[model samples]
Target chain A: MPDKEKFFEQIVRENRDKLYRICRACLADPDDAKDLYQEVLVKVWLHLHTFRGEAKLSTWLYRIALNTAILYRKQQNKHTPLLPQHISELPDASAETAHKQEQEVLLQKLHYCISCLEKQDRLIISLVLEEVSYKEIAEVLGLTVSHVGVKINRVKQKLALLMEQQAGAEIELDKADKR
Target chain B: MNFEEIQKNWQTQQAPAAEAKAGGATAESDLLVRVKVLQRKVMRTNLLVAIVISLTAVAFVFILRPLLNPNTIWYDVGMGLTLGAAFALGLLHWFKSMPWKKQVNLSSKAYVEQVLKKLHYLNTANQRLTPFFMVAILAGINLIYFDIFWNENIKLRLVMHIMLNAFMISVGAISLYYSKRHNDQSYEPIIQELEELQQKLEEV
Candidate 1:
């Protein structure tokens, strides 16, 4: 109906950031995150016409990004000798050399915590992190708003416990270095 | 800071702010490129398979149907194969040229799901024609064997007919059994994967 090329370019330009952030959320390493981000963009470009406008564009985008990441993860698991660098390649953590080590430490813990979540919980966190409304997140994720709220609270608590444990480990390592 | 506080801060500043540099290429970009390449490759493979299978099927039809009758010629076989190939190739081209690219979206899940569905439909259609395939092969074999038997002026016609019938029945039975078994196992994985894909979509 619309000029196909123009419509696709507009959708890509408009939603690129959100898509990129979701990619970063799913992937651990920055390089891998960036790679996943671009992949999502290309997919969005190719699939933009299917948008149908039934849900918010963000929800639709989330659907695509999450599915792609999960498929990629599933595929990676099938191969032997998972790449070591994959864990450290997160985009935000890898961007600055000075903060890279600390950011990586924090991200590694975050990664483990997120991975432990149920698929629905992971969707909630990704959406919440992207600053989507609780209602919108529910709509995008096909959950009740109350259910989303409760899940978000539970995930937040779980993440807190995980971060605390990582913090304790860091303190122990600091003490050993001092000794 | 507590994780909640840090996460809240992180969320507030998350994505919309970085919209300015949306055009730049990043490492994540590479993964996307690879995915596109793979998608195209899969599409090509599917087209090739459809063409080859259709040609083989049509060729089988021509060879078997005319063997009992004297009207068909060897050239009919070649013509049938060519026509089947051209028809299948045309359908493949139509699908490829369709704006399937615009429907791919952020995950490529929808497109992949469509591709899987197409494959399943093809398999089912192919399976439905399988009985015809078996009958045609047997008919063709009988005609050729009859020609040879007639040419040799071979006697014991009762024994030859009985043996040929038994052999055809046995072969048909074996093929049907294996076909059912293979189809069940193959379809299970695809159905399971499609279910998983649906679950993932709902979660999204």
Candidate 2:
């Protein structure tokens, strides 16, 4: 009802998916991602007053979510899972078509490949996937726009290679299964 | 899957579906309450600590002094020790409140850099502050019985002073060693991580 509560709710509702996805992108564990998201929210609420309307709220939220994840995962170095163990379930998989199922598999592979890149690269690509502009990504990451462009190119190439390797491995497994 | 295609799918994907997704209005209200409660709790605890410290200092200076009838220099030593302790607590308080600084709005690299600076400053300040206080307090304690004992047996007073000083020095030195070790152990990993992040962002 109060102004602060209204502002907090609005911000959370608006950026809920973005924050959750950022957490997911950076951390390999869903539980850890959830924890990181909560920590980010706690920070946002605590530091709500410090928001001086300088940066867009989403950009500010991105900075907080990401900075928290980097620092939080610094303490959780041992929890890294080398697989795409994070892709638990496709949303409403049973109701979707076979084409949708194939898309889900590719999405799974994408998650796996994203998990394989460097931590900062993973975060940058997540923002890039969200259609965030290079300038905003640079701002969120404290990088030059040109550097973001450079890193995105590199990460995208790496991700593509990783995905190709992953898909090739999957096809081999399928052939073996057929044999 | 092509990069452009995956990028498109990423946008259309329904959700990673965070586990904390509780019912809408109720859950948000609960979170708001929890955050507010936590903020209030920290403030209350800090206030209580400050009050208790003030009360103890007052009781020591006013009540204990008149009751014991010690030398005037003894009171000065007590005052010095109190001020030393207050100074340490003040620095710690500042450290706890460091996050509220206006730098939060800075970009992530600048934010991490600033945090690293503060952490390094806190570490160095702690390393320097501890020994400085140890020496100051040790001097104060060593001075305490001096005016009284100095007037009497010079050898006995010298022996007592040396014993007390030796005890204070040994205790202070051991604690200082452990304190510095603890600080490094706790701060080093975080500092290392922040440095790595800084480098990652700084790299082209």
Worst 10 residues of 1 chain A by lDDT: A78-87
> Which pairs clash (backbone N, Cα, C closer than 3 Å) in model 2?
none
Provide the global lDDT of candidate 2 against the true structure: 0.70
Work out the TM-score per prediction: 0.48, 0.56
- A51-84: candidate 1 lDDT, tens digit per residue: 8888877788888888777766665452232233
Per-chain TM-score of chain A in candidate 1 equals 0.73
The DockQ of each candidate is 0.10, 0.10
Which residue runs of candidate 1 sit more than 4 Å off their true CA positions? A29-32, A78-119, B2-5, B8-204
Candidate 2 — which residues are off by over 4 angstroms?
Answer: A82-96, B14-204
Error of 1 at B113 (Å): 19
The window of 10 residues in a row where model 2 chain B has the poorest summed lDDT is B17-26
- TM-score of the A-chain for all models: 0.73, 0.89
Q: In model 2, how large is the Cα lDDT of residue A7? A: 85
